[model samples]
Target: MTSLPEDPSPMLNEADRDTAVQRLQQAYAEGHIPHEDLDERLHQILTARTRADLVSPLASFPEEEDAGTAFTIAAAGGRIKRQGAWRVPRTLKVESAYARVHLDLSRAVIEHPVIDIELQLGTGKAKITAPRDAIVDFEDLHTGWKDTLYKPPRRSVSGGPTIRISGTMGYGRLKIRHARR
Candidate 1:
């Protein structure tokens, strides 16, 4: 006899199953997932009776539309980082004081054509790595006791979204760069 999981997943309805199947098919068509993964996830989703059983199969897929959180990442003298394969919301606000923050969007899932990032930092360091084709605009960003100077070697391509960063940073360091494709 075997024991059950601590938290059993709730059973899935027909609509939920249909949505999952459609997401898998769309991901496959967009080349987000390989052929093997598409086949495996389709099988898993078909056989999955509960929502929790679909976790592993849909792990590599991006979240559905409006699935990203809308809350700001607030920190006080702490470290905050958003790296690797993560979802990036359209509008993001980061507030911190004496904290170290790093945001790497090299392998992120961006679902918008324009992204707005408002950073309010005080006495700390922040590093943002955007996609190579992304256009970063910080002209309206103000700094006290230090200036935010950003000069890219080359112009941004007409591919990725335009990232607009505006806020006030006091005596802190801000580094922004475009990651290679």
Candidate 2:
């Protein structure tokens, strides 16, 4: 990991670099990095040559220790539901087969502005109920199921966490819904 000078005027281009810089800024705002270190990292990000170069500067950023709170529900042939008030981690992985899984994030205590949901299902139903203000991104999810109730966001939205849904839905139904409030 090569170091760079702290100069705001450093040259930058690629979109990935921009996103990395924004993540660093978010971490700094969360007090994960001090002012001096952030400035140095920001400079490195600005002048980074490859994606791997940008990654090194962010390696020191603190990861959420609350990942243990992430809800991982695997049902072979039953109903699995995560409702009521719960802690929403930075990543939520769900694996289901011949079962029904429901994730209720309306009353969840979200600790980040971005959440990743990895879904792997087979011949079952998986439903995610989140707050109406949430920005659900399921563009990368490909399901062989014909009756999916997911409605991909038509436009960009903010003011809430961006729920990124990925992985395979298998021969199951996946739905992205909102809480009734």
Which numbered prediction scores highest in TM-score against the true structure?
1
Candidate 1 structure lDDT: 0.79
Model 1 bad stretches (over 4 Å): 1-69, 151-155
Question: Number of clashes in every candidate structure?
Answer: 0, 0
Model 2, position 22, has a per-residue lDDT of 73
Clashes in candidate 1: how many?
0
lDDT of model 2 at residue 124? 77
- What candidate 2 gets wrong by more than 4 Å, as runs, is 1-71, 151-157
**Model 2 lDDT tens row, 1-181:** 1122334443444656767777788788877788989878998888887665776778876653544466676768788788887888788888877778888888998878889998888777788887767888887788886555865444545477888988887777888876655
Candidate 1 C-alpha lDDT tens digits along 25-108: 867866779987777789999999998876777678655555354658898888989999998888888998888889988799
Q: What is the lDDT of residue 6 in candidate 1?
A: 41
**Count: clashes, candidate 2:** 0
